[model samples]
Target: MKAVVVNEGGALSIQNIEMPKITSPDQILVKVAYCGLCGSDIPRIFHHGAHFYPITLGHEFSGTVVDTGHGVTEFDNGDLICCVPLLPCFKCDECQKHYYSLCKNYTFVGSRIAGGFAEYIVLDKKNAFKLPKGISPLEGAFFEPMTVGMHALLLADGCEGKNVVIVGGGTIGLLAMQCAKAMGAKSVAVIDINQQRLDLAKKLGADAVYHSQKLSSEAIHQALSSSRFDQVVLETAGSPVTVNLSIEIAGPRAKIALVGTLHHDITLPEKTFGLILRKELQILGSWMNYSAPWPGKEWQLVSQYFIDGKIKLDELIAGMGDFDSFIKQVTALNGRPMNGKILLNCM
Candidate 1:
């Protein structure tokens, strides 16, 4: 098996490694075909180490089952599948209450353990979800990201006929923009510092797009004819600027969902901090997708949206490359932002 491993000092290498195998009767071995480069993978590779060094790093993926353990009845040797990356201890308090994302005892694929960066990875049947008929390996690989966008919307609650603003045009941001529209937002706007990404957001269904370099938060009011969102989604959490910006743009009593990962502390300026109290805003923090309903019900809805042509990724797939080339793509992309998804052709 070949995998891209993170060794000491966060260095990455595409090396041939031992093949992962099923240790329990409920496990299944998937021959990874395609794996998408998630935003989270960049930091783990180049900065803070998640688990021990020498671990694989990829979670957004889909593959075919090459082998199944004796107890795996729902999946066969040839089944195409996507998986939930979180490996939760089912006996934990959170897991028992159907809150797997909040489970205190958990190991995440691509972080705490070997992930889809390898040729083959083993998973329990509990984490695997069969892809729908005709779902391509590339599309199946994106199921995780789609679920992420869905969960963010779920956290924000209603979107029907209300103005919404997404404060980042990355994968999660773009997906949230489309999901907001699909769920019936009267109009949606996407804000990002990158012009190319904001342009892609417009193409994807955002009614308005703002490049932070060209448009100030107040400038958005003019773009949308003095409109303010009933809800605001802050998806660019890594930046303190965007976190404060989310607070600046939210409407009175509007809810804000913090879906982005904020690696650093966010210190709100006096006026910005005052917005929450002045507007009576509701700030909701959301984490990973769930599996209480069995590998997550949001996965099912996202798959169906793809099937019905309401959602598509043809424009978002920037390129696909082999293992070594895949490493370069992600390495370069971390510094230079692009409009859509990039994948490693693990096969």
Candidate 2:
């Protein structure tokens, strides 16, 4: 099978490798259909080198079940499925507490195990969920990222009747806006350095959009003086500038959730300490979900929403190209601006 392998930092090559074998009875083999290149995967593959090379690097994907193990009764051949990507040791203390993300022995699909970037990938039958009826495999590839947004909104407390602000207008940031609105936020605003992305956000569901370059701290304060955001969510993984700005614009006692990642050190302003102490703000850091909020709710909530048209997953697709062309497109966007998510059609 042909697969893209990163042998080292700043290196990626497409090569023919042996297909992965099902080594365990609880595993199911899936033939890759489509995989989305997430922002985190790009940096981890090329920048910090956290992704071990000679291994597949895509985690956000969906495929059809080719075969199932002896004990696999829940799924069968021809059934399409998407997984949580986290394979946790169910006996661990954190798993016992239903916090699989914090499990000491947690293993993610793309990072710790062979991921979905190849023609075939194996997943624990326990972690895979059947793709709901009428959900396309392409849209199924987005379930992982959507779950991240769902987790962030849950971590932000409740969005009901609250004014919310989301920093960054990328895929994750835009998805976060939709999640906030679904949770009943009265008004939602998305801010980004890219005008193109902010425009896309408005088209999706953002009630208002602002370009970071056009708005300074004073401008933000003036805009919010009449209606300050009760919840602020940050999905820009670029720098800490937006994180601190989220802090600055938050209403008194507002909740702030950081959903994006920063590779470099983040510094908070000196006044932030005073603001935190005086305003009683609650700041929370969020990441990929652990898959434990409700029974089968992970895919069901998101799948139903997309299937029923509550969220516009179609508009989120920015670019789609063949294998080689797709890779070039991703690498080219390294320092350029992106208005939406990019996908690769491996079939």
Candidate 3:
């Protein structure tokens, strides 16, 4: 099996590795067909020494089942499936409380464990979801990120009849916007410094889009004051500036969800405390979809959203280049299209 591995920090290479074998009754082996390169993968590969050297590096993916262990009943060989990627000890207190995403022993594919940047990977039956008939494998590859948005919305409660503002126009941010709209936000606004992403956001149903760089702090304040959105969603990778900017624009009594990974420390405004205290704002953090129901039910939720036209999945795809080319193209971030998710076909 050929897999892309990061030998060490700042080192990446393709090597022939032995295929993973399934030894547990609850495990299933998937022959990967497509995988999406998430922005986090780059930092893990280049900056953080999180992954063991020579480990595969991909988490968001979809494929067909090549084999299943003795007790597997939900799926058989040849079924299309997507993985949740988070491996958890199902007997833990967190798991018992339906907070598997917060399990102390949680591990994810392509990060702390073997992953989908390879020809085959073995996953627990609980982590693999069967794809719906109408969805293509390429689109199915997006289920992981979409599930992140779904999980974030779940944390924020219902979006019905509320004005929602998403800070950042990246893949997660854009996906969150679509999900917020589908959940029935009265209006959805996306903020980004890039016009291309804003245009893409418009195509995907953002009610209003703004160029963050061009707007002065007063202008930003004026804009927020005018819209007065009750819900603020952050998926822009928690860049410090964006974090404070998000807090600055939030309306009174607003609910804010943090779906982005803050790479560096950010300076927050003292007024942020005033808003939280005076307005009773809610701050929530969401991680990957690792809890509840089986992986099949979760993937079905994403698939249903796609089938029912709640999310514009296809429009978010920036390119369909080959797997290797996609790695090169997507890894180099430009201001524009940084907000869109790119897919790579491994088959």
Candidate 4:
């Protein structure tokens, strides 16, 4: 089998590696179909952020089951599935409490072990989720990011009948906007530095879009006809600026979910810090997408929404190609402004 391997010092190559086989009774061997490139992949591939060298980095992927071990009863050959990349130790205290995402000992697929950037891979039965009939392999590949947005919403206690503000227009941010609308938010507003993403947000049903570069925080409030968002504010940009903006624009007692991965230190201004006390805000720190019963409701809901046509993914795909094209795309990541998801067809 051929797999894309990231060697030490950030060099990538497509090499022939031995095919992974099912070694556990609760495992399944899958033929890779599609894999979505995540924003985090950029750092791991180019910035030496990987846990180890010679890694195959891809977590958001979908595939077809070719064989299942005897212990796997829920899935069989020919099943279309999307993977839950977290491999949690079921014996840990966090795992005992059904907090799989917070498990003290956890290994991720793309980061800690072999991932789905190849022709085939093996997955534990617990990590493989079957896709519904209407969802395509490309759409199935989106399940991971879609679940991420849904996980943030769940942490904020959902968005129904509330004014929601998402402070990013990347794939996760845009998906959160659509999920908010699908869950019956009164209004959904998206803020971003990128005009292309803002436009894409509007096309996907955002009630309003704001270019962060052009609008002052005051102006954004005025445009929305509100002093601040009263219900929910999701900070998904993972930047210091957007983090503070989420604090600035949140109304009293608003449930604010921090969904993005922060790479820099953030020191809140005195006024910003004071708002938390004065407004009695609910600050929720969202982690990876997982809950009780293994992969949890986030995955189930995302799969159902995709089947029901409540979410749109085609517009979020900025590029798609095979392995050679994937190599070129990876090379182009430096100094490039990526506004959408890039996909690789592994088979």
Best by TM-score: 4
Error of 2 at 254 (Å): 0.6
Candidate 1, residues 1-347: lDDT per residue as tens digits?
88888776656788877788789999999999899878787767767645677678889999999998998899998889987898888898889887888989988878777789888999888768898897888888988988887776776765777788888888878776777777788888888888888778888888788887777877764565556646555565457888888877677777788888877888988988898999899988878887557666678778887777677687788878998888777777544444578888976
Top model number, lDDT? 4
RMSD of 4: 1.4
What's model 3's lDDT at 107?
A: 73
**lDDT, each prediction:** 0.79, 0.76, 0.76, 0.87
- Clash pairs for candidate 3: 170-339
User: On a 0 to 100 scale, what is the lDDT of residue 117 in model 4?
Assistant: 91
Off by over 4 Å in 4: 225-230, 335-337
The RMSD of every model to the true structure, in order and in angstroms, is 2.0, 2.1, 2.5, 1.4
In candidate 1, which residue ranges exceed 4 Å CA deviation? 222-229, 333-339
Taking the tens digit of each residue's C-alpha lDDT, what string does model 4 give over 176-231?
89888888899999999889888888899998899989998767756766625557
TM-score of each: 0.93, 0.93, 0.91, 0.97
Give the least accurate 10-residue stretch of model 1, judged by summed lDDT: 229-238
User: Is candidate 1 or 3 superior in TM-score?
Assistant: 1
